[model samples]
Target: MSELLSVQGLTVTPANNPGKKLVNNVSFTLQSGKTTCIVGESGSGKSLTALSVMGLLATSLNRTSGSIQFQGNEITHLSNDALSRIRGKQIGMIFQEPMTSLNPVLTVGFQIGESLTVHLGLKGDALKAKIAALLEQVGIPPERANAYPDELSGGQRQRVMIAMSIACEPKMLIADEPTTALDVTVQAQILALLDELKTRMNMGMLFITHDFGVVADIADDVLVMFRGEVVEAGSVDEVLFKPQHPYTKALLDCVPDAEGKKQLKPIDYSWLEAA
Candidate 1:
């Protein structure tokens, strides 16, 4: 099957210096219904790469050179209006912080249904039914639909964000640390929910985070980014277990334990015996 999203020769620069780059020659393909993780420590520009695909870069920065093709259409030069149309309908996003992403003044239902209104032009009973169904799909009760963000727990708020992201059933979803602020169990649940949604919707996923544990639990493929470049990338096993990059090894060394232990043993080095 053809790639659902393809990024080529992607390079991004800070607005302050149009010539100086932050994301250099970054590129990857997202296949339908599979999870691709962008893993790296801080300053790796993983999040920025995802933003470039969504055309959600900061107003100041520019795509110096490269093409972002969504289902064969080059989106690099797409207008703001065109990008807006493609955003919620063709590409959905779940930010790291749900509280900040969602409107404090709006009811959860309103925020969840806003995409339906914008992307599907849904209203009245159709919108109502859709919103209710979306809440349920994301594992939230219909009663809580009318509740404000302040009234919900951190996990529940994240659910609302997921509901909003999957509202239009976009072909591709970008989850930027969807489990950042939640408890361990809640984080597991959210990852499971995203996993289920991806399978059910047949959606491609670009999951960005610094957490290797989360990536291990959910990623099909891993792209290890370092200093704005993809140092290593392949199947999860290749990148996680049999990694060839020193930066990748350094990252895996830092996946901490609940007891606040010194470091974690390498997954392959500890998990299995050599064949």
Candidate 2:
């Protein structure tokens, strides 16, 4: 339960327009072995917040202000080379779409081994063995490691992404809607696998999603974002069962109940103007 990452006063703005903040001042802390879910609709800046922490904001966007501390060390302004050293080894990220994130030409095994080779200096038989082990760990057969990303199913491709992220046994993981593109059953399986891995390795996880159902299944803490600001933050039960913010309540109203007893409603933001 130790503090693994701390982010304070994070702000992201366009390179040309410093005053136009895409992601306004936001703050949160993630502890080891815990999952913190950032729940928001599209364009609410949840992904931007995660990118700022990873130092992966696009060239068009600039992180104007923030203090990103990982394992008590400030990484807000680290150079690309310095951040590269920490990225795969200490902090790993699973992008939303596995197909685009993975290289189609390279074998999945080779791709997985790249991080292990670069970070741990593993090679030859040792590297291959580790790659096989990682594939197995993520529920993919070791033999499939030789196959290309295009050859695998969508679920399998996502599993490959997960395998690659956890291969280095990083202390923290940032997953940006990793299950968004998968089917329902596969989504559940991937979520379960991630939860199991996080607990086993005690890795702190920052999960980004718009689904409250997913949040209920995975989140230890929840942060509800609206237009680049965290409108509500609390434990899973407090936020889900006893939401304090109107935006949170509105968002929850959109989710359909399991027994079809609750009517799904679209979020209405007209109240904001009146407020």
Candidate 3:
């Protein structure tokens, strides 16, 4: 029930426009063992907000105001090394594209072990054992650990990415459209995987996605972002069924209903593939 991370009055500006803020007064709290989803259309600064909390924002941008605290400790001003240590070890990231986030030359085993080596100080047989366990945990075959990224299917590649992210067993997992670029069934499988892992690891997850369908499926709490601000936020039922904001209602109204199509489930969208 404790807050894992809290962002308050957050505002950031790109180097190009010191006067113009891209993220405006955004605030949210991610509690332990719960999933807080930020749903918004493209360019709404959902990912930016996640990056800011993770201390993974690009050097070209600066936090002009507000505070980001993790486990009750302020991180917005932490040294680069301190933040990096926390970024992957205490907080893991699953980017939108697995192909881009993963290594081109390294085998799946190596990428998964990379984090263990860096954060957990694992090596040799211990590292191999851990990597295999991670692969299996994420639903990848043990044999596939030796395979390269390009040689695997989209879903398989994503599994590898997940394995790598959870290698350190971080307290928080920030997934920026993690299911993007997969088939419908694959998306469900991946979501189920995340749900299972979150429960097992007791992790606080900040899932950033444009898909309301996903929000309906997996979110514990929802924040609807628009034009650099949260337009609506509440429990899923409140935000989805009884949306209070016009923008939130508009976004929800855009969700496709497949009641007429027997094969199309309302909550089943192919977010496994990139939109």
Off by over 4 Å in 1: 257-275
Candidate that scores best on lDDT? 2
Best-first order by lDDT = 2, 1, 3
What digit string (tens of lDDT, one per residue) describes model 1 on residues 1-275? 89999998899998889877789898889899999999987888988899899889998888899888999889888898999999989899999999899899999999988889988999999999999999999899988989999999999999999999999999999999889889989999999999999999999999998998998989999999877888888999888889887778878888876684748554343321331
Please estimate how well model 1 matches the true structure, expressed as its whole-model Cα lDDT.
0.90
| Maximum-TM-score candidate | 2
Ranking by TM-score: 2, 1, 3
Query: By summed lDDT, which 10 consecutive residues of candidate 1 come out lowest?
Result: 266-275
Cα RMSDs of all predictions? 4.8, 1.3, 5.6
TM-score (all chains, Cα) for each model: 0.93, 0.97, 0.93
* Tens digit per residue, CA lDDT, model 2, 1-275: 55899999998999999999888889999999999999999999999999888888899999988899999999977899999899988999998899999999999999999999999999999999999999999999999989999999999999999999999999999999999999989999999999999999999999999999999999999999999999999999999999998899999998868974646677888779878
TM-score of 2: 0.97
Off by over 4 Å in 3: 260-275
